[model samples]
Target: MSALVPALEVFLVFLRLGLTSFGGPVAHLGYYRAELVVRRGWFTEAGYAELVAVAQFLPGPASSQVGMASGLLRAGWPGLLAAWVGFTLPSAAVMFALALGMARWGEVEGAGWLAGLKVAAVAVVAQAVAGLWGQLVTDRRRAVLALGVAAALLVLPGAGAQVGALLVCALAGWHLLPAPQSTERGLPAVPVSRRVGATLLLVCGAGLVLLPLLAPLSEVWALLNATFRAGALVFGGGHVVLPLLEAGFVPALVSHEHFVAGYGAANAVPGPLFTFATFLGAAQTQMPPLWGAVIATLGVFLPGALLMAGTLPFWAVLAARPGARSALAGLNAGVVGLLLAALYTPVFTGGVRGPRDLAVAVLAYAALTAGRLPAWAVVLACAAVGWAVL
Candidate 1:
């Protein structure tokens, strides 16, 4: 009964965050810091920083991983589940509902509002690229690495190339880049055991390998496989998942316009940007809408959840290793490159049709970075402008 109370508390707190946290992944981190670190004191500053580091080092939504870690520290395994469900439920529901609307109103493809949403995606992704570049491309080596990865993807352009670029960057970082100094803060004591962590990691690996083979069986399998791969390989942050998901679903599963629009809608909603999967899943025509939403949401989130849980027990050891740190640095730079390529292709090309559209995007970018408007407000403003002018 006492344990149950803690898990319930975890759920309620995260549910509130899901309902209210906005502005995308970076902003979501600030909200988490304020709520958990400042108000409730669930973790010390250094402890929370350590948790964030672990999430960034692993492939998943970094903010969501931090939430999971917080829940695990507070209430054990039950807390982890509780945290994810609470934080994810609100946005997932909203995105799925939007998918339903799109399904029914097939003519919305030509709607001005939809076009606005697509255009808003341009500014949103540009903001992400700029932010990531500032953080990841700190040195000349990292800049070269990021530019090289971007150039490679621009030339070749596919999921295979993205993955290959990440691999090459990791190797380069390991061999050439200097190791980053370890942070002084120690990790909090997590309840997971090393054995359990190892088992979970094995499951993540097995899914990556087996899901693809099983994808030929049905639409459900294919949806699960694609979403799972996106979750597993996404390294930097939620925005970085864009190109991977775009590669998996665009044109074939979901239309290009719908893809861009859904991404824009994702910015307007609270909680994890990864909930964008819920919208994509439900929007697909091959499977039952609700069922697709459920499966896609689960598949995209599962790998990250498993990896975060598995790595918690091993994080202390890994954080101390210089080689691991260097590789992660390289991988992060590669991620910036991947996002840069995506911004130009699907985000820019899909959204901007003329000078008018470019003007709207520039204004939207200014509103976000300079005016400091909330992302939802900016998205809504862009939609209005796109409807009236563009």
Candidate 2:
């Protein structure tokens, strides 16, 4: 199908998902798989699995990256753009509103609502890690890799550390893990040329290096640089960006409490966790909050978009290779490890300040596991419980 024929379909589908897909990045992928792969037959099971593998390997939000890749497969670059914009619009807008509101009443509102949001985040992330553990960690080798990566990141936590851990995993997978026989089911061809993708990738790297240097000249430049670096470096998506961005802005551009609170509030929203950038930007005093949100959001997500553009054309060919498949399996295991580490530090320790908080998180997790309540509903339920008891 041509780009135009699929552009509207892509936008509408993602917009629907954006309004309702709430558990986090992993949950978002599940939603996409159910809707696009299972229900719609948009792609084969192998194709969907390959997208997840590629997205897990790339920096930025993995679910968003997968969604964009699906778009590229469906109708080239325009469809990719449409998919991102549609999926992100609802959460981005909600986050912008929260950012503006936080400037006025963050402390007051955070007492109850944000508290519940925090615990809710804890529960949601826990659920995601639990669900993904089985699907991704099917073998003893991968299980060991997950444990190893999680332990290493917990001890030496940062974006750089996370990247290093992933590299180690990839190398281990390459040498230690047995290579599989190639099952080169050809993937749907995207319209982007290899040359076009390469050029975009080069631009992304240059911008990553140049943006921060320009920060001294302009505040916006600095914000972009910080966000760009956050986007560019990192293996695990969503919760993993926490450390990268925390070191970048906390106690300088934004306060520690606000940074943490924004994370909690972000969970209550639908769409990509990267929209947390929107909140961080709005929290900034360097520029008008909305403008800050816009630029920061742009800066943080730019690398992933450019990388997707550069890589989509070549992803199918590379993913079909047996060695590449093994490496990606290791990478997914690494992400699962990162998720476990995050569950302990930021998701659990950060939110569960006391017994009451832990209780709330437990209830939320139970609700999520029950599958009776949607994520947004669970978030609201937690908020009510927090106000009444927490």
Clashing residue pairs in all predictions, respectively, total 0, 0
Cα lDDT of model 1 by residue, 112-187, tens digit: 7656766776777677677667755789999999899989988997545766788898789888887766542334
What are the TM-scores, per candidate, against the unseen true structure? 0.65, 0.70
Candidate 1 Cα misplacement greater than 4 A, ranges: 103-187, 317-390
TM-score of candidate 2 to 2 decimals: 0.70
Best by lDDT: 1
**TM-score of model 1 relative to the true fold?**
0.65
* True-vs-predicted CA distance for residue 338, candidate 1, Å: 18
In candidate 1, list every pair of residues with a backbone clash. Answer: none
